[model samples]
Target chain A: MTSSSVPKRSRSAMDASAAATQALYGASDPGLRIRSIVFRSALLLSMTVALIAIIGIISWAVVEGGQRLSLGLLTNNPSSFRPETAGYRPAILGSFQIIAGVIALIIPLGVGAALYLEQFANKQRWYNRAIELNIQNLAGVPSIVFGILGLAFIVRGPLDMGFIAAAGSATIALLVLPTVILASREAIKAVPPSLLEGAMALGVTRWQAVWKMVLPAAAPGMLTGIILAVARAIGEAAPLLLVGAATFVTFDPNFWEGGYSALPVMIYQYAGRPQDEFHVLAAAGVLVMLGLVVVVNSVAVWLRAKYERTW
Target chain B: MKELGKEKLMAESASTKEEVFSLDGVNVYYGDSLAVKDVSFPIYKNEITSLIGPSGCGKSTILRSLNRMNDLIPGARVEGDLQYHGADIYGSDIDPVQVRKIIGMVFQKPNPFPKSIYENVAFGPQTLGMKGNLDDIVEEALVGAALWDEVKDRLKDNAFGMSGGQQQRLCIARTIAVKPDVILMDEPCSALDPVSTYKIEDLMMKLKEDYTIVIVTHNMQQAARVADKTAFFTVSSNDEEGSRTGVLVEFDETGKIFSNPADQRTQDYVTGRFG
Candidate 1:
């Protein structure tokens, strides 16, 4: 009834309305557009800077030591007297043994600690809160502090494990243990709580539910963390120095006893030398260490992509 | 026709039916706050009891207490008597695991383990160490949930690959795999489409022949469609303290509650006037 009585807009009024609509949809503020562009460029610049630094180091190492990358570099033992024929057999073996020990130590201890904290510990309790805070703090502590701890407690004071590859392994394990635990806790926390409830609703005990459902679901993420932590342990030289990774270990290192020389430690030793040949050898060692870390990290990324649950 | 038959059966059994759960003056609390206060109701055996309410009305809390699922939450406590059969479910000697084995639950969301279809169903029977052929048990549970025909060809396929409704049905199959006497469904079809919801409703009707079901539903029509008895819950607020608590306003046969409710609040709720 009111529609018939309603007055229509004048021609000029309709034209002005169309003009206002045009103005509303025309363009964003120029200042806002410039601000967005600036923000994006800043992010791109930061990422490019990091990428360039990594590529620069890698390329420099290849240029300096490209010719020296041979089977002999892996086969022949290091010799200060003959840098031309020198290799890193003993150091490679030592690094392998130390890393093997580190893997054996960290996997069980770190995963168990993470499970206890994530699945069982009550956050309301003061002690559990304290433990959580302590772990986060430990991850931030310098790697060299763990070296000092390993030297004082493990090498000399309590366990009395002398200068051996086992000492180096234990030291490096301690250095990366916090990282493994933190990553594992994060992985466990990422698993949906609904899965746990679903399992428990079927009459399984909490432990059964965790072991059967939670662990398997979180396995890929936990493994990614473990692999990254192991990579970090492999590259450690500061902690191993205090734990007795000898500079010029001629023989292959034993796990429990005898002098050890990891790849990074050997690189550090060669880089410290005055001879130009040893410097080349050190650059070549850097390539080998970088290759090993790259391989381990690749496995972690592959495992994550292949198994991570989207739900 | 099916609805008429179900209603007829319900009316015939109204007098002779046994009570599966009897709650008297139950109060549920989370830490220092009382979430649900003085709720009393009876859930009959071999019947689908629907608890209908708006969000945050403690229907889910009361449902979780049936199988002691709330024990998983720290500082959550239940007071007063909740009797399952003749025994107190929260007795000092009663084990929560055992309680859950007999009274399984299906959650609001379909949460299947990241495993094969067969493995998801088999997990329950394997955990309980049930004496039977594992394959047969998995098949039976799947068939019971009305999913065997669709999933039989892909028993080994991962459960996550299925559609959302299929996944929810798989969850239901998982619950029934251990042969529980009672199943608590917490809005099992809330995440499903209309067709899937109808499929589940039909499945629930068939399941009540063997297992008792108590469902918490937000959909009033769903409660009227499949539930034999309906319990209406509403949130009550204290003006002085500004604290909200869920209270059971009415409980009766589904038809009566929807058609002619006793309480004004239940009338308001069922007619979509207020919640």
Candidate 2:
């Protein structure tokens, strides 16, 4: 019996050593220590790189544009020859109009689509699945593709609206609709099914239940989606170019007609110009665009916090 | 009016109470699979009927069917007659929403709207256009659910601020706000602590004096304590392909079902021999 127990005693001793090792380094294998350190360092390095890039861009824009940023930049109109005198007045107004139009278009349409897909559609049906898959794919498609579609359809084809600010708004709205829908659908799905059931049990119609309970529960998340979409819409230059966003405009744009210049389009034109003053102007425009996006996102975050529901 | 009320109560006690619901050969199916098979029973007005069974026995399914709650589930269909006041609930002209207005339900988990306590109780009445002094109606409903005393001071607070049991009672108050004739509870106390469960049990006993109550519970003791009648359900599985169906084995007055059950399965279940 002593001989038999000797090997068992050694095995237990080995287990104790393994336990000691795990307690020290979180793993039994000593080699895993180096591996875990290396893995952790790599992950940290990757995140640091992203953080550095964002900070560098913001700093560079502020430093480059700080001197040129002024009330004049906000008040004057774009001029190719007189870069110092030029401002983004028309572009600012036009961009605001486009954003407003995009919001008006996307909120109802995207939320409606999300509600129908998440709450009403029969998911087992092939067509519904196809529609869902297509929406996801559409969100990933290049914004330029949407611009082309808007140009061909809204500006030139059956609808035959002109190359107007509203046309650009339509294009951007179409570009971001998938993003809004996907996000809104996720928000709607996050609502506990119990809330809907409780409301329905009270004899309310299905629409009433969704309208009263699900929508309120989902409003915060939906607002976040809209804000992100708006940020994406405001920064897009290529799409607006395709939809005829004018590179140069001295006058404020009418909504449905006339030439319009957006901040991104103006920045693109200014940055391409062969002059130091124009380059500074481009940086200033970029800073303004970034500021607007930050403001919109801040508002979204505030709204989410204000309406956060625990359940 | 007080004398008239007493006289009516005496008459109602002397005569057999009216049946609120009578099920005849009911089989509930989700898509092609049967969940509950051949359930037949009568639920009398102003009495508590508890459906008790082991897991997967479809007690909740039978309770939900009474108020057409199963209609919310896609591909769920019920065959055979489930009558409310002698009218078939499955008839072509019968609206599920209208049916729900008369027969309210509480779920296993308490689900109050993320609104104020006042709003949570007021929602159903507001939506259904229940005309009265709104505050009075809310207070009366809360009082009836035995929650007014605890919640009256914090009526404007968020419903989620309440403890679990209070939230459950708030749900009960919300249901009563609409003045439903019958209330279906599916394991309302399962999520509560023992003390909270006792409180809800006491509340349900009081509720049965006004509204007919049907409860589905896993706790046999709970059924014995608060139920006037008991239905024991058990899972019946077919050997071929391992399909399971919930079958009602026995149903009787609570006393007889607990003390001297007619079926062997009921005796086994009640005596703790086997589920």
Candidate 2 per-residue C-alpha lDDT over A1-311 given as tens digits, one digit per residue, 9 for 90 to 100 = 45566788787897899899879887557688789999999999999999999999889889998788898998898898999899999999999999999999999999999999999999889999999999999999998899899989988998888889999999999999999999999999999999999999999999999999999899899999999899888898888998879548899888888899899999999999999999999999889999999998888889888877666
lDDT of 2 by residue, B56-150 (tens): 99999999999899998988999999987777888887788977877899999999999999999999999888899899999999999999999
C-alpha DockQ for predicted model 2? 0.71
Give me candidate 2's TM-score against the actual structure: 0.93
As for model 2, its CA RMSD to the true structure in angstroms is 7.1
What is the CAPRI rating of model 1's predicted complex? medium
Worst 10 residues of 1 chain A by lDDT: A1-10
How big an interface RMSD has model 2? 0.6
The window of 10 residues in a row where model 2 chain B has the poorest summed lDDT is B1-10
Model 1 misses residue B81 by how many Å? 0.5
